[model samples]
Each structure stands twice: as structure tokens, then as C-alpha cells.
Target: MSDYLSNPLELFSVAGKVAVVTGASGAFGEVAAEVLAAAGAKLVLAAGKKAELAAIAEKCRARGAEVAEVNVRPTSEAVCDELVRTAVATFGRVDILVVASGKNDVAKIVDMAPERFLDVMDANVTQSWLVARAFTKQLLAQGGGGKIVLMSSARGLLGHPAGYTAYCASKSAVDGITKALGCELGTQGITVNAIAPTVFRSPLTAWMFEENDNATAVRKGFLGRVPVGRLGEPQDLAGPLLFLASAASDFYTGHVLYADGGYTAG
Candidate 1:
């Protein structure tokens, strides 16, 4: 056997790598951390809730990966800077960063309060930008390339049928940010990408399933419209996240990958 072929296991591996995931206490963030751990990454779990972050860190530890936790609003530039410091201090380097903290509130543009609109924008877009900037800076300073993953949604691509003016605006802003930054930083070897998921079971989507009538209608609507006849799970984020974290997507940047159940096709 050739020496190169003998090391085939090196590809698709994250051994000795460190990843920082924001919103690690949330369903999606927790799954992302666990999956990365399974793939051989030390994890730095960032979230606003202290208790929940600790819990998830323990879970990642149980999976045979090192883990640390940081509490931050995620939207604040100062907080994002601190998160990078925390990750570097924990593992000595940050190989990947996932900006996954987000919120969805119903606020029609005509009737929405200014503060509410600002809240959605700050949480969904501004925070992602802050995190991305801080991590990219760290990577440059460390003299190594890095991967950045932004959490966007299908709503960012299409208009909402109901009242989602603020949420939609925030997500669309994220798509723009991802593309713009990816172009600016591509030459620096920092690949930026966004994941657009369909209706997934999370706190952001809980309202759609509330009340039997609303829930049934939403389910049926998705079933009829989407080619894939099922809702997405937290694990749905695993593979794409890994690809972005690894060398597989080295030539890719500024792309919006739809992890939807073909919801965007029609």
C-alpha cells in the first residue's frame, strides 16, 4: 500500500481541532457541538444561558471531546471578541466557528415597534457579523486559515406568507453579510458560508406548531409544498457543518446552502 493511501482516515477528520459554537445550549447548537465532538473536535460552547451551556459542555465531554463554555449576547461586538479569546485560551487555537444564535419574533413592518425591529436585526444579523469578524481576525493573527458558518434560514430567501417582516429582514441581512464577507475574506483563506434550513423543530418554530388547527395546517402545507415530506431534525445540520469546518469546502465561499426539504424548489 502507498504511504498516502495508508493515511486515508486523515481526510474528513477533525482530530485535534477546536471549534467554537455559539448558542450551544439551543437544540441546533447542542447537536452541532456533539457532532463536531464525535468527529474529533474540542468544543467551546457559547450561549447566553450559563446553566444550559454548562450542561452541553458536560455532554460534549461525555462524547470524548474537550469542551468549554462562554456566556454572551452574541450580537455585541465586545462579546464576540471575548468568545474568541475564550476559545483560544481553552484550546490554544480555533479551527472553526459557528454563529448559530438567532431569534424569530412576529412583527409586521407596518405595525412593528422600532425597538422590536432593531432587536431582531441586532440578534440575527449584527451578532453574526460580530462573531465572524472576531474569528476571522483571530485566524489571521494566528497565521492559519479558518472556517466560519453562519446560521440563516429559508425565510431569508423567500418572503413570509404571514407576519414576519422583522424576522425576514434580519435573515436577508445575514445572507448579504455572508456573501459580502466571504468575498472580502476569501483571499485571506477564511471561507464563509450560510446554511438555510426549512421549518425545523426549535424554539423559533414552536409557534407554528401551537394550536391544533395552526399546527395541522402548517404541517400539511409543508407536506404538500416541500418535496421532502418531513420536518428537519437538529442532526440535519451535522454534515454541512462538518464540510464547512473541514478542507472539503476549501474552494467554496459565499454560498448559501439550503438544507431544506426542497422547500425552496417550488
Candidate 2:
């Protein structure tokens, strides 16, 4: 047996692999890129903001990872195709893909506008599908097994009393995509999975933990439902991202790994 099979730690090594991370400018994407880079993977980072993508590329480079930055709307199929081509041209191949780009619009069903709901769906669901499809094409062409990690949310699996009509619907769609793709792609040596997280401390969710009466009440209410009694941190997702990106999760597909603090379990 190879050292990787004998030494389990070796299975988690993503050294020398090339990873393409979408939503690289977002809070979760930034952390995911850092974790992959820290594991010795070369990175192709994509986001709608050029400046933010550039900044993230710099950080990854500082970690000794060869990095490329792509500024493109991941929702565009043409743009997503270009992203895959760019990764291949820069790093020779794409071994892993992380679709961390998403959007959430909080509005009650009665108050939500149809356009806004569709926009949320386009951003969270359609964009992810386009990006994943683009990369999967490259992986199939290259004839090697690959890894795809989609970002789902705890909201995808469970509904909330709060205004979450658009957000919840979009993410639920993402969960379906993950499972369907995982089943369809398994035969090609590709594994598709998702990470579903509960309320985490990201820039997008910072308000909930801020110092204020409402924030305090929100925190208390959220924590009451969580068995772990604590919100998630960016670093908390690093290990999970690495595991799904590496060979450690070779046999796992069509799986939604919840990183929630027992919120889903409860």
C-alpha cells in the first residue's frame, strides 16, 4: 500500500493540487481559500470584485501558494467556462472546486418581491450550478477524479420563523443540486458534497453578535436552539473544507456535512 493508504494523515494532504474557489472575496470563500492554500494547493480565486479577489490572492501567495485571480460573475456560463480554462492554463489542471458564492435576501413571503426572490435564486443556485458544471467538464476531459464542495446552509434543511423566504428557498435548491450531482458524478471518480452551516460569525452575519439589545436578544435566541451553545467561526470551517477537498473524503458523496453547532440535530 502507498504511504497515503497506510498513513491516514497523508490522505488529507492536498499538496501540489490545484483548486478553484468561487466567491473568493466572500467571508466563507476567503477562509476556504486560505485553508486550501495552507495545505499546499495552488489556487485560482474568483469573485465579482476585482479588488477583493486581488487582495485574497495576495494573502494566498503570502502562504506560498501559486495563485490566480479571476473577476467574473459566476452566474454566467461563459464566464464560468473561462474560469475553468484559466485554471487549466495557469496550473495545468483543476483537482478541486469549491462553490462558496451565494446570496441571501431576508424578507417575508408576503413582503418579498418576485424579482428579488428570483435574483436570490439566480445568485445562490444558478451561479453555483454554472460554476460546478464548468469545472466538472474540465475534470471529465482531464480524465481524473475530482472533488466538488458546494456551500449549503442550515436554512436549506430547516425553515426559520424569521424573514427567510428567498434565502431559504435558494439554499434548499442548492442542497438538491448537491445530492443530484453527487449521485450522477460518482462514477467518474468525482465526489460532490456540501457543507451546511448554521449561523456563523462572518462579516455578513456580524450584526447578530454585535453589542446591542437586539443583537444580544438575537444571540440568546439563536444559542438557545444550538446544542453547542456557541456560534460558528471561520476557522471552524477550515478543517471541514480541507477534508472535502482532499482524498480523506474519497468515499463520501451526496453527503451534506453540517458544520452547524448541533442546530440541525436539535
Per-residue lDDT over 118-180 for candidate 1, one digit per residue giving the tens place of the 0 to 100 score? 888888988888888899889999885888989898999899867798888898999999899
Best by lDDT: 2
lDDT of each: 0.85, 0.92
Model 2 ranges off by over 4 Å: 1-5
In candidate 1, position 16 carries an lDDT of 83
TM-score of 1: 0.92
lDDT of 2 by residue, 26-76 (tens): 988999999998899999999989999999999999999999888877978
TM-score of each: 0.92, 0.97
